[model samples]
Target chain A: MIPLIQAAIVAVFLGTWQMLSPALGLQFFFATPLAVFQSLWALMKSGLLFYHAGITSLEAVAGFLLGGTLGMGIGILLGRHQLLAKVLAPFLTAIYSLPKAALAPLFILWFGIGIDMKIFLAGSIVFFLVFLNTFHGVREVSHEQIAILRLMKANERHLLTKVIIPSAIVWVFAGLRLSVPYALIGAILGEIIAANRGLGFLISSAAGRFDTAGTFAALIAIMFLALVLNRAITFAEGRLMPWRAAEEGREVPI
Target chain B: MPGPTAPPSRKSSEALPLIEFRNVGKTFARGALEAVRDVNLSVAPGEFLTLVGPSGCGKSTLLNMTAGLFLPTTGEVRYAGAVVADINVRVGYMTQVDHLLPWRTLAGNIAVPLEIAGRPKREIAAEVERLMTLVGLTGFGASYPSQLSGGMRKRAALARLFAYDPETLLMDEPFAALDAQMRLVLQVELKRLCRLLGKTVLFVTHDVDEAVALGDRCIVFTSRPGRVRQAITVDLPGDRDLRVLRYDPAYLAQCGALWRLLTPPVEPAVAPQGRRE
Candidate 1:
């Protein structure tokens, strides 16, 4: 009930601002909040909201999977082979240093104004983040534990499956949390640059036609999408790492 | 009788020590320092040896050589009269660090070796349950290491080693993190388990009481660039429990002497000539 009242207050304040915008001559640029909500309601009624949202969500999910898998694989590999990681460290850093947005034009040249461009762009951004995190996670695994396993005559496969991967998964989940928003941003940026569909395209096209309310509506939809994706990943992380929550109070005596 | 006992061994006490360190010298920091030097030692199969020392005395380094985790810089460590070259498979080890994989359930961590050894799924499950029960973790099979007490995690570590049932055990300060009562409980369990299994053990600790309570013989060590100071036989009665031996006059006397051996000698206070009465 408190939350609902707080929200109501925010809504009323915004509504008053919207009412005063025309009188204050701020309606042209400010995009009255009521107008934005009404436009969003219209898009929902017409089913256009889900259409653009579906396209953007699909692209983001595809990119996330592509980048996350490849990142994890190479991350674990590079993490396992320190020499290889050292050799490639500078080159990887140079590439990662450039803003992922700078790759937009190049991605467009290769994949054209389709989902492919956005997917690749998103995948690349997500990949580097996950890779770096997984690498650090693998390296941070206790050398003592590895020594203990070795004394048991544990082979490399045993070490990898039993210890290394499980430890690294914690970082992978962290990467997932950080990468989800970036994943959406990547997908939307590609659409904004050239795509015919997606929330980004909807917002760009609306802005071009001076429909500021429509632009606000699309932005709000994108925010909702990012929130949902982030929530899903958070759920997965909790399920995958049940031990972590228990660790803080780990030593309760019997 | 309530705990898992050691399997019967036909080898007699007169048989050669299963593990021997001959003139073993281990140098660390690129040979800047010798952690241990000319350490000559042997443990007959099924004999329990406790090594006690102050910090930085290389007691753990000595145990590591026997486990083949560290190769002696100057001399070789032998197992059953043969020099161990690589990580030795014949020994089960528990170190001071937390080794229980947090991701695995208690049962899963305990069954790691069996899985590595290619044991079948059904048998692995059964064996894990058995080991858990042996370590008094009967209902904790599904719990992760993070959910357990410090002592409980030690039990899980102990169970993991026992699952492999190696001929020898090398433990380095395994219960050093626990409170006094917990340490005693775990130490008693280790003693009971070692005696019943007839497993040869090279255990390392700084606590003299623990060394006396669990060891057949306690080896005292000197400070850095360590070497054996002296070896003291515990002489606690056979067929006895650690709790009983902990308070026994014989045990306390041995612990006292070993503590003296471990501590640096105190220099006599000198009186100033000007202040002489």
Candidate 2:
């Protein structure tokens, strides 16, 4: 039923765009759905679609992995150490508040206009998201729960492995899920600013050529990629935390 | 027999108290709130001593001191002849809420202590299985805490507590959240388990009935800055059924006595400030 509603919403949006395009002479600025699909089909047939999408997907996935792991590690570290967390809190807040997209240009200059630059861009953005969530996740673990493990003669290692890490995984997953789009955005923005490949390059180059349909097609591809990635995270979360899944299942009656 | 029978030292009179609070006092929020004051108490080995008091009365504070979650602001809590200055691993502390890791299955949660203790895989598995059966959770070992009923979660928490077989159990209203029937059932179950295993218990609850039902001796604490107002030995047989005992006239009289001690006086008490919390 939700899928049907989503389909209807998409159809209505396309219908509106298609109807308003020629009427308003908006084809150059906002291409009709038919034109976008035709360009998408042309790109697919020529294999350019896969090339650009693959590059973007690689950048996003790589960035997500690199940033997610680093973020989670540091988050756990800070979460466990009160003094260190206190020392770094202000600096983290300052850096986190800055618009991550603004760092793309700096990353391009620092890492060059290669996939490295895009990966760094995406990874840096993802890092803070995962780190903040993981930190809070680790920090917010009920002291009672930790105390329970402590009373069992659990050492620091035991507490971390058995309770802290597993408890924080829930938050880590949440942060990862949230950062999926941001990761793509970071990669794509870097590619647009300076890159020969990726969906962002395709979108920017098409727009520069005034090929509105091509740009729209690239955007549609990004939307699909984000959707798939988000779904993958949700699936992983269910697999890792069966208890959380059970909780959600129980909530369905209400 | 019906009155509050003050026994100076009931069980294990010949042996030194397994746990002793030597003039223990605790103040919180930088001495703003006096939670417990000058508490001098002792519990014998294998004794099921229950502490009953009103809210904010610091009954739980004493348990915390014993568990070494924290120290008394003044004086010391001695466990096994040594002052508790660190996280007391020889005792298992169970709070009101079931602290079963929601990420782990019932079997997995129960296996936590054993795993932490580095018991062999087979041994941990067997112990988990045994605990599940002991707590009537045999078929639900695979279930998550969220998947289980409140009663079941409590049982899982209890199982987890017993996994390491801690010498002493510090329980703070561990069954207060359950329904009346479930609470009674768990009370009986806990009493039975503690007896069978010979675990010294320091159970804290506000319920006078629960204190009477479970304890070898019940300590009634005065409201906030909780001092021990009375100590009454519950002479009920160890193996008695709680269901039958609840109706026994002697049980009723004991509950009444504890209730009186727990309740603040009607007229006095600093003009009864803003309800009994």
Candidate 3:
């Protein structure tokens, strides 16, 4: 109730002051909420929103899946075998520290200004996020628990399925949830850098023509897509880890 | 009960010692610190052996060595006459803290070992339900570990250990975390289960009474680089009830003997604060 009331207060302020009232003679630059929504409606009616949004979503989701799986595999593999982690630690650190998105141009050079570029871009970003998280997850898995399973005469298959994977799922989901925004960022940014389609292109191209309303509309669409994806991951996480409810239920000090 | 020494002669007819630590010595910090040293012990088949030691005595370390979680630095640990080269699955381990997989319900926790063994689904379910009832968790099968009390969690852990019906049990203070009443209750239940299943057990704890009550033979350990101070063969009957055993003269005698060995008069004083030379 408090949040709803707070949101209403902000919405009323924005609607009245930013739209209803006259601006300080800056209409060309600052797109009002009303103008952004108007442009959004226009794009939706023209069916452009569906096409661009669809392309971005496809690139983001596919990249997310590909990167997430690759990251998890590498993470767990390295995590389970510390020797591999030691050998690759410096390399991973250096790569991870670099601005991965800066490589978008290089990827464009290799993969061209097509969906492939955007997909690879998004995959690279999401891969590191999930890899680091899964690695930490595997590390945090209790040695005592592993010892217990081993004493039960569990084979390697049992260790992975019964102990390793289940233990790492929580961290994997955390990485997945955080990757939603990064996935969109990667896809949209890649699109803006070179592509002729996607929300990123829509915003960048519109800005070139000084279409502030169109830019705002594209930005809002990106936010909406991110929210939807994040909600999806959250829903899946809840379904997968009902046990976490106990830990979450305990009151945390603010 | 046959005397602990009589086991050597009876080995011809009975099963051999299920586990043996051959002059085991474990050093940590690349040999900088010794946790347990010069420890040689054996547990016969279906026998209950309790290890009593002071805090940080590395009694648990010895158990880990036998489980093949850690290799002895200077000697070898053997299970069923074979050197433990990897994780030994012939034993079921119960830690001092009940590591009930929080995600799983009580029944699901019990089903873990069986499920890992690739038992039939129906069999796992039946066995889980049966073990839950056996551990006095009959109707609490669906409840998660967090929902249960500490003692109940311990029982659930015990059931999970028993799920696979392993021939040997390597327990590291499994009841130490419980309350006094719960500990006694669990001791009785555990004794009954172990006897019925004919499982060999290597139980570790710091409590002398608990050691005497549950063990056929009790090995007392000195602290820090733990070595055997004495090995007292307990005289209590195998099937003795926890209540009666608590007051048994022989039980007290054995417990007292171990206590004397562990905490002799003129006990070592607290270490110097390193202030004055």
Candidate 4:
């Protein structure tokens, strides 16, 4: 029943947009749903959609993994080491607050408008989100839990793996979930600035030609990609922390 | 009717003191708050000693010092004839909160200590099962801490504490968070386990009845800047059921005595009528 309502909502929205396009002179700017579908069909047949979408997906995933790993590592390190964290805190905050789009052109200059540039831009954006969450997560772990493990003769490795990492996992996942869209945005922004391929290039190249339908097709593809990635993350979190799911399950019935 | 008191164990008194506090005092926040002061006490091996005091009177501080979580501000805490300067891994500490890893199942949480010791898979599994049964959590081994009741979680913590088989247990009101009926049940279970394992326990509580019911010797502390007011030997038989023991005349007398010891002295200026509010 919920799925039916959701599907009906989408149908009605598209139907209204398609019907009102000609009356409102929106066809040239927003494009009709039929026109956008036609544009998508054309791109699919020519395999341009797959080629560009593949490049964009690769950039986003690569950026997300590299950035997420580095963020988690640095966050854990800084969280554990007070002196190092204190010294580097100001610089990290400054970098974190900077508009990521402003860094795209600079990244392009550094990495020469290649896949490296897009990856670096997306990765840098992802790094801070994951890093901030993971750092706080590590810091916020119950000191009582740490003490318990210590008294149980837990060495540093055991504490990290068993207590610290597990305790901070929820925050890490929060960061990961939050950064997925930002990762795509960073990749697309880099491609818009200087790339010859990727979904961002498709959108920019279409807009340059005033092809509203083509631009909309690329955007719809990007939205779908974001949805898939977010779903994948949610799945991984559930797999990794089954106990957390059980906890929530216990709460709902009451 | 038996006498109100007998005597503390001669066996424990004869044994070498496993934990000793020499002129121990602790002040936190750069001497802004004094938690305990000029405390000198010792726990003999295999003795179940309870520290009874008002809240913020530094009962927990004494246990923390024994665990080597922090050092005393003025003096020292010694365990097994050596000054404890680091985390003492030989003692198991349980506080009011269970502190179970939320992501781990009961079996997994209980297996923590054994895992830390690098026990093999089969052994850890066997030990975890034994502990689960010991704590009456037999079939609930697969359950997470969040799935359990307050009493059940406490049992899981008790199982986890016993998994490593530490020689001494430092419990800071471990069952204080439970309901009255559950608290009594756990108290009996804890006493039984402590006796069965021959563990030397330093249990802290504000409950006068609890202090009298559990300990071989109960040490009463004055309210804040907690100093030992008296150390009373409970002298009760170890095997008595806690429910029956609660109504025993001797037990009631001990509890009454501990209550009086814990009551703060009235100030001269404060009117007696004003104290009611």
Residue pairs whose backbone atoms clash in candidate 2: none
Model 2's alpha-carbon lDDT is 0.86
Model 1 agreement with the true structure over B6-115: per-residue lDDT tens digits? 43222334567788888999998899987998888877777888898767878889877888776899888999889998788889888776588888888888988888
Question: Which has the greatest lDDT?
Answer: 4
| TM-score to native of every candidate shown | 0.87, 0.88, 0.87, 0.88
Lowest summed lDDT over 10 consecutive residues: which window, candidate 4 chain A? A245-254
Q: lDDT score, residue A63, model 3?
A: 92
Compute the lDDT of residue B49 as modeled in candidate 4: 96
DockQ of each: 0.52, 0.69, 0.57, 0.75
Give the per-residue lDDT digits (tens) of candidate 2, residues A21-95. 999998888888999999999999999999999999999999999999999999999999999999999999999
List, residue by residue over B1-277, the lDDT tens digit for candidate 2: 1322223235655768999998999999999999999898888877889898778889989999999999999999999999999999899988778888888888999998888888999999998998888767888988878877777888788888877778789888888667787677677777777777677899988777888988888887777788877788898876668988868998898888777665654335542344454
Report every candidate's CA lDDT. 0.84, 0.86, 0.83, 0.88
Residue range B116-198, candidate 4, lDDT tens digits? 99999999999999888876788998898889888889888988988887889999888776778767767887787777767
Interface C-alpha RMSD per candidate, 1 decimal: 1.6, 0.9, 1.6, 0.8
Report candidate 1's interface RMSD in Å: 1.6
Per-residue CA lDDT of model 1 for A83-192, tens digit only, reads 99999999999999999999999988999888999999999999998998899889988877887887677899989988898899999888878899999989999999
Q: Pick the candidate with the highest DockQ.
A: 4
Q: For residues B187-232, what per-residue lDDT tens digits would candidate 3 score against the true structure?
A: 8877877777676788998777888888878888776778876777
> Between which residue pairs do clashes occur in model 3?
none
Question: How far does residue B37 in candidate 1 sit from its true spot (Å)?
Answer: 3.2
